[model samples]
Target: MCETNHNHNIKLDKNGNCNTDEHKTWNRRSFLQALGLVGGGSMMLANTPLSVSRPSPLSIALSQSTNENILVLVRLQGGNDGFNTIIPVYDYDVYANARPLIRIPPSEFINLSDDYAMPKPMNKLESVWGEGQMKVVHGVGYENSSLSHFKGSDIYANTNLQEDDRTGFMGRYFGEIYPDYFFNPPPSPPSLQIGSIGNLIFKGPESDYSFAVSDPRRLLQIIENETFYNLDGVDENCTYGEKLRFLREATNTTFDYAEVISAAYERSPEYTDSSYQDDSLGRQFRIISRLIRGGLGTKVYLVTLGGFDTHNNQIQRHQQLLTSFSEAVSTFYKDLAADQSEDWAGRVLTMTMSEFGRRFRENGSLGTDHGTAAPTMFFGPALNGSGFVGEHPDLNNLTRGGNVTNTVDFRQVYATVMKDWLCVDEGLVGRSLLDTDGGPFESLDLGFNCSGTTSNIPSDGESLSHIPTYSDSQTFINIVTPQTTHIDVSLYNIVGQKVATLANEMLMEGVNMVINVKDSANTRLSTGPYVYQIKTNNGDYSKSIIIS
Candidate 1:
């Protein structure tokens, strides 16, 4: 049944879709090679088998699972400068001293309480803040963080430090939740990335869980012409031809999605308001809003906006990017909250990511260099999104070339969203996200009422650093033992509710152990306020932690 159809007087229309031959290759591999997506999207083209060895993902939603929450993930392709973006009101003097040229003027910032402030460009988000739907998780990074764009992004995407990995956090998490995705797809693609499809975030073991189209119209053109890149009954005998066949088969599936996205696009209304910027980021958010409003059952959505890597002429460039970012988010929220679809305001939680944050000190170019540890944000109506979470950035003490040490591990955020928001099972959380050598990261309590229940996870602790604040996201509980003694460190809210037990062990004499405190369901702590107590043979030492 396989035949070779060479490129000869190929008849086609405006749209790129193959009309006569839907299964022949008119040099499809060459087209893919040009874009560099084969390796990124498919991973190992010839090496890895079509199927992977793992448990079936069909039964991911167990009986005790929480309600399915929609997560809108956005990635700032280039490293973002957290210091300039999130002004350090607590240490403005030091921050200003560090970057006199690049530092955001105090007056040009929106003060978020007494401790934190954001640049004026972020001022428009005041409404989001006022609604308590803007939360800032300070100092997000991991150990041995990479400075290179490729390496750092891989670290965040894979959550694993391994270099040769194509498996992404979203891919694994979604894969488990919808094990039968390949055989029985979701109502819509489980996750839809607006721009490029070279991302591995939604990659599955045997196949990818998401779809890729540079532009809906481009795909539509390709489909409208029925110019499907056919692989001439791809014969397995020819490796290149066989590969083309495989890609052709995948492209056929892509045709299926083109129709779906086109429908969603048609359903979305035009933006008549002036709030939305006429920029790319704005356009992407606009599409996302329409898709979600159009009842796309997509559980997770990723929207990426690059140009954050500000190495030169950053003042204008950075401001523009932030402005676009803030406006896009604000406009998206407003659009969702409109009378046409008011219920989704709280239903969708928008979170941000970056490969890494720029160096603490400004470089000679009046810009910032790639560094470690930066701020990540969570915004939406449902979450108590206001207030700063995690340890505040310490400008005075910079590490390994003036980089801010991470206070809260990024994986904790994923864990929180997965367990608390999406209600994914604990086991999948471990298998999906990589944080402490493939760990089930301690869930951070973002103060979201996932099941109409109050969380009491004690907030972040602010005191002298018992443990030099590293890039890891764990909050420390310093305990110095005088003699061989048994100690118990317990977390509690102001109302005397025992929230969690950080450590319960017997220590040898004259030993100090720094414990990490995280908020989870069992040890629920709200974002408002909380306290912690450590009981030992020598007596009890207590400290306070502010969760928000």
Candidate 2:
């Protein structure tokens, strides 16, 4: 709704000529018409294809099918600090020395194992991590990663390291499925962007395959009731007339899209997922979840959590962003579970993507500068690869470029998703990602790793498999689960003073959890008489562990 600048003192006639009394001023409509004819934008959608009335726009899944692979792509807008996000347990000293100003203190680190630990703020993902539902792919980047957010994001989205292609990986996928999307859009909306459509990540060869609206309810109101008023008659034979016709026709198609989106929104369930973080990200995911729960048949969804460009005062801001993201994502999965959707856990996959990562060393401004490789995380019920995927880049030995060298090619990830999750042809996936040579890029193993079980075991059947062995370095707890839920355990001195919080996490069912315990450093526990307790969602259980 940008207004065109015009000279205010001039009086003009209806024909856009200078006059004396009445001024027929130019406005948005005429400006749009001018653009329509001048740029010939109307030619883009000249022929309305017959399939506009198709069941859904670019429909890929059957409404009654429960096995469709659903992908929830999360864009981390700013460069994320991979070192801080996934603390390096092996190179703690080097990492701390590099970013002393913004490092997470050793004492406060949450122990995942002797090899790795996450920031305490990441505790929301503890349950997911424990169940092997999360995968941390480290050192994800392309060669010569761009430092500029705009350029880096484009590279990531376009998957064109050469910066030569205009089509994104997803865009190409959509284009392959719906060759003439401009003329005959899917019966239902193909892809949905929760908030602003930040980029053309979903742009096809000739047109964009997705649509975005700020609010569903408001969109419904606008499409169903709002009216557009065009100006009165002018010359029908003039250049302006033809341009006006194009603009009006384009306007009509836009209205049609609005109506389709509103109908899909109405089809979504009335109840919103309540576990969200009550922020923009949360609100957006809520919309996504309801659409899935209500069976909208949308194949792709784009969710964003921006403000990652932490060039200054990053400690608090980064933590807040991670917290919001963690809570919303963790809860979104749970919300799907609460709905008791049969295939949600197995069908829906959520992955995080970023433009790039910050430098290893802290800058003078108390924030790390933009740099290269970072970790990408994935969570879902059908995830086979959990924990760390690639070896963490050596902090002591950085590349000559002063960045963590990529351990996993970003295209490998794209190829994996295309083939494993979205079921694209392997040959198409390989070319879509790595370009001309290969038929299928190496697919990362993201299959469901844990065993499925019925959650009907009796309360008395659950217990610690054995007394956990403890030392100053660590402790091991073998907790057998009857069902999947929350579990917390702690150690106490002889006098009942709590010594260490060993495990406060969610555990999946039907697995023996060899839980590890450690303080800040990867050291064993002290020798002494200690008592341990285990708490489950069902009830509390306790045992003794004599480290001596």
- What's each prediction's TM-score? 0.66, 0.65
Candidate 1 C-alpha lDDT tens digits along 40-128: 33111112101111111122221123344678888998998988888888888898888889889877978888878888888778888
- Model 2, 27-98: lDDT tens digits are 322354345321111111111101111122212221111336678889888888888888887888888888
lDDT values for all models? 0.65, 0.64
- Model 2 superposed RMSD (Cα): 26.4
- What TM-score does prediction 1 earn? 0.66
